[model samples]
Target: MPTKDHYAAITTTLLVWGLSGALFGALFVGLYQVSWSLGLPGWQTLLVATMIAAMTTSAFYSAMPVALVGTMAGVLASISYLIAFGLKAELITIAGVAGVAGVAAGSLYAWMVTRGSRPLAEILNGLIAGLLAGGLLVLAFALTGWQVNMFVLAAVAVACVGTLFQLSDGWLVDRVAHWLPAMLSAPVVAGVIAAVVGASIWFIGGTTTALLDDRMTAALEEILSSIPSGLLGGFVGGALSGLLLEFLGFRLEAGR
Candidate 1:
């Protein structure tokens, strides 16, 4: 039977992650619009946007370590974006790059949230989680192209990497306790959960975008329409996943 705490976790995760996704979608599209309108370089715009999001992560938790960790995460993410633009990479390539960057950012997030405790363990586990999360994103991009939007994928991937890294010692330890230590188990669990959640969101958002595109007038318009599609998918998928994860005994720690 579901307890009151379970219901609360479900409600909270749904609202928080859903809003987070919508915000990410808006920021992503908004940056593109700014780049187009101002004739600004895409790399420059991406850098600015990534920095803002990175800093916002620490700020969101009101953590004291925001300065160092946020700056590092922002720089890492921005560099990936710059590289992607320079290479004129396809969506799959971009997704892979985003996963690598997400791992670094997530590690930083864990460090901050835990107030610098267990540095080596957190980073190593985060790396393993990254491989899983990154591969999943690559697969998702290959399947859906731009229908789901990169922002939503990256947001969920990065956030999960951090949260899952934190959880490696809890339930995951039991599942892999026979073969692996707590640190190793964290990544496996985190990666799997992230993949499932990310893929589900991709399917939902991509499907919605496809349906919407069928009624649209032009290529550019159809592309632009994905923003709302991402928003809807993020909310619905986030809510559903939150419920499932909570029921399965997954929990996120509040910012310290």
Candidate 2:
């Protein structure tokens, strides 16, 4: 018994969530790279990069009111990276954790914000969905020891950037104003967010690379190679979860 408006809202929410997840993943990648590249100590790079990224991303989507969702997603994404580091003690592990966390957090936040009528139910469902998404990415990473290279990293970054620009200039603004459908706007927003996130991750990786001694650089590279796949996992997981929520009949509003 859904109306056209209802369907439209659901679709838009999914797109936005997915796009946001991807962008956030990219930011983590960039942060990791920057941290390593800068020769800063452990965690210091991550802390600075995350704060900057959170502020930057939040400011860009200030009008969406779901800005907090993005910020929360960022925090969760960072936590994932930290968890990965603790769990596997590998750079790739960190990447995997970041991706899973971003997808889960972003999807859950979007669903909760959009499903205003049943906030509690929506949140419960979203949490389940997020957990599943994160779990899946971790599984995928385990199954595939993906490697990251400069060329591969650059490709992901460019793709995310293209998507981000599309969101900033395209339907995202209109979607926020109720002037356009979320499906159209969400993807665009997700793309931009992904790019920004990727940049942050790259930053972290680069920083890590610089700090290590020559003897450790090769080992670091091997570990960092898993980042690209981790990012992809996070982006896809988030998008799928958001889409799943929409298919199940959730509605989203302009701001939470």
Per-prediction TM-score to the true structure, in the order listed: 0.36, 0.34
Best by TM-score: 1
TM-score of model 1 vs. true structure: 0.36
Worst 10 residues of 1 by lDDT: 187-196
Q: Taking the tens digit of each residue's C-alpha lDDT, what string does model 2 give over 1-256?
A: 8689877877666566555555445554555465667587634543443333333333343324333444345445655554454323344444444444444554555555452322222222222333333344335445886555533443333233323333342333333344343332332333334334433453354545555578677645643674565456435644565555445543333353
Candidate 1 stretches greater than 4 Å from native: 1-6, 24-132, 140-228, 252-256
Q: Write the per-residue lDDT of candidate 1 for residues 81-187, one digit (tens) a residue.
A: 54545434333443344444445554545544543323223334444544454455446556776543554543554444334434563434334434434332222
* lDDT (0 to 1) per candidate: 0.42, 0.44
Winning candidate number (lDDT):
2
**How many clashing residue pairs, candidate 2?**
49
Clashes of each: 0, 49
